[model samples]
Target: MASSNVTSFSHSTFVLIGIPGLEAAHVWIAFPLCSIYIITLLGNATILFIIKTEPSLHAPMYIFLSILAVIDLLLSTSTMPKMLTLLWFDSTVISFNACLVQMFLIHSLSAIESTILLAMAFDRFVAICHPLRHASILTNPLTAKITLMAVIRGALFFVPLPLLIKRLPFCRKNILTHSYCVHQDVMKLACGDTTPNIVYGLMAILMVMGVDSLLIFLSYVLILRAVLKLASRERLKAFNTCVSHLCAVLIFYIPLIGLSVIHRFGNRLAPTAHIIMGNVYLFVPPVLNPIVYGAKTKQIRRRIVRIRTEQKGKITGIYKNKQMIKW
Candidate 1:
């Protein structure tokens, strides 16, 4: 029976443990998770809508932001709904193929987001470091090419992940740690050799995130060097432009680092800690990114306020017209 199980990858299924040792609290825990998902969807959608409709926002920075918004939408959507199902409906079963698909989406989207953030850093670097050539350097065609490259790079790098996992034989240890599938968690359950999966996954992460992070840091260092040459007032103004992106960088990387640390080094920690960190790593950025940009970005902030003001005026006009008709 065990040998048969080892041979049958097609018939294998995995069960997701939503939050280990907290099964009884799953329903109660779902309320906040659902709220976060809804907020992520709405917030990112609003960012995209504003950037799309507002002509003044048709620049390189906003363009990158819109791409980030789309990524956030896809990233959260990839994992949250299934997580909610596990929490609310107690539906824990996921097929091997489905699990692979989920893992691919989650990891690929993360790669893309990291690339986008790095691109945004470069955009800022060019803007601050070479203000005169900003427009020439980041033309529409170039921006489009950059966006396309980020997508293609992310997708192509992880294409091997699912294929590698597919080749692994499972020996019936098919339980997962999180609500959604991840390459690391799923790879652990396979009874076959996981050294290839481990080595490949690490290489992919280093190539995508590790390299991007180093470049982003280098870009900022150059940007700071350029900014320091300006007068104090000009330096302040230039630094202000990067505030939102800096906040975004912090929010994104902090949780991710925390989760990675917990996964690798904190095995003695409670499973709940691991689960909560994972959720925060996935959910917090989407929920907070829009809010950060909306508040710190002057153009987006003014547009949002103008929209609300116009909406209020229209509502008042309709109410007055109805009152007049009643009279």
Candidate 2:
């Protein structure tokens, strides 16, 4: 059995189903997927632009949010373009090397996003729990260090995944269930023993998601504890500071948990169900993060509106100049 499993596929390629059970609806699905890609790009871009241009948003919270917007942009770009091409053009065949690259970027950048969220949560905790020392605690150098930590943690934890998966012989199958590549999905196609891949993948998930989530939760718990001690109006005011971050956290982690559950326990179900959950996990956060922050945070919303108003004024001014020229 071991000898039979030793077949090589180093030069082989893989076919991604794009959306296994929804192949018939690829064109229809492209509408929403493309919309998501556009919105994620535009929204995150706006956030980054506003944060850069607006002096009021230079605080630690907004700076962290800008970092998150960058993460979302990268995370969405890593998978959406290929998925969109697969849906519209039926370009499903991917070189194994490209597939590995997609897997690494998607998983690693996503882990970084989660780490950033944890960092943001801690920022909120400090701002709320230790209001006076917010500046001293989350200093510019410290934020830079946190940024480095997030990148290093994500890059280091999953660095081995692609390497491990690359060594596996893909004699069993190369057709992936989802549009993009993932380690677990690819591991299922390997004919060789997959224990190391499975163990490492699970360990990464547990270490990254498990630890990040626990700390984020604890940060919120402490934040809530701090809020409770404040007078009622101040309590609401303090709690409001965290609402945007909380919404972003929920938007990201909930779908992640759903996808992980479906991946682990729903093997017996219809393949389409799994695919929908996987896409949902990928699509929702990037789409919603900007919206949530723009809606919940005043400075971001004001800047967005202020830019729009300025543009409108420019257009109106141009119209008046045209009228004067006509006269």
Candidate 3:
């Protein structure tokens, strides 16, 4: 199954037909994709801005949240622009190196985002389970170390993915099923035996996502046990602190799991459904995170509302002055 020209893989280009079997609908698909991208950018940016400027939000929880915002921004930007270009302008060709870079960024950023979620879950677990030691447990220095480790973990694990793909003989049709390049997605195009790639990729996922997911669940379980011991009112308040994080987690994982299951098992499913599911998990968290946080967290909501109110007041004041002007 070796490709005819192994060296050609280095110079080969791949075509990303936005959604297979739905080429005619690419123009219409642009609307929702663009909207999701716009909202993701605006929402994540606003969250980071507010977190950075609001002194009240300088705690460990908010610090982790800002890290999450950055991850969301990076993850969304890694593929959304190229995707929109493909969908709107019918620009489907991507050079091999460019595709490799995109694949690396998307995978690494995803790994980093997963680690951040685990960190956030840890933060909540500590705060709820051992309230008195929360500050000492999650210090700024420790948080910084966590962030650094997350970054390094993602980089170290995902660096090999691009290299692995680069070594493969991709002499097939060179058409990607989706708009982006992922290890599995790109591996499918290679003409050589892909057993090693598939094995390594699955192992990478198990190491990064599988372990992180297990730990996150363990954290929540401990948190639940702790919450149960609190007074009724305190229990509600404690759970309230977790609502936004919970929403963010669900938005990120539920669709993600669904998509993964469908991909692995639902070969006979409609292509449109497959495409939509793929896009949903990829696009939802970035768009919904800030909205969920702002709407659910009272302090964040108040700060965002105040900013809007101040802007409205300034606009109103300017309009009133225009009525008093002698033009």
> What TM-score against the true fold does each predicted structure earn?
0.95, 0.95, 0.94
- Candidate 3 — which pairs collide? none
lDDT of 1 by residue, 85-169 (tens): 8888878778878888989998889989999999999999999998999999999999999999999999999989999999988
Stretches off by above 4 angstroms in model 3 are 1-11
Clashes of 3: 0
Q: What C-alpha lDDT, on a 0 to 100 scale, does residue 194 get in candidate 3?
A: 84
Consecutive 10-residue window with the lowest summed lDDT within model 3: 1-10
RMSD of each: 3.0, 3.6, 3.4
Candidate 3 per-residue lDDT over residues 110-152, each given as its tens digit: 7888888899999999999988999999999999999999999
Report clashes for each candidate as comma-separated counts.
0, 0, 0
Report the error of model 2 at residue 67, Å: 1.0
Model 2, range 1-327, lDDT digits (tens) per residue?
A: 112213434346777776655668888889888988999999999999999988888887888899999988988898898888888888877888998898999899989999989989999998998889989999988999999999999999998999998787666645777888898899998889999999999999999988999999999889888899999999999999899999999998998998899889998989888888888888889989999999999888888898999999999999999999999
For all candidates in order, the CA lDDT equals: 0.89, 0.88, 0.84
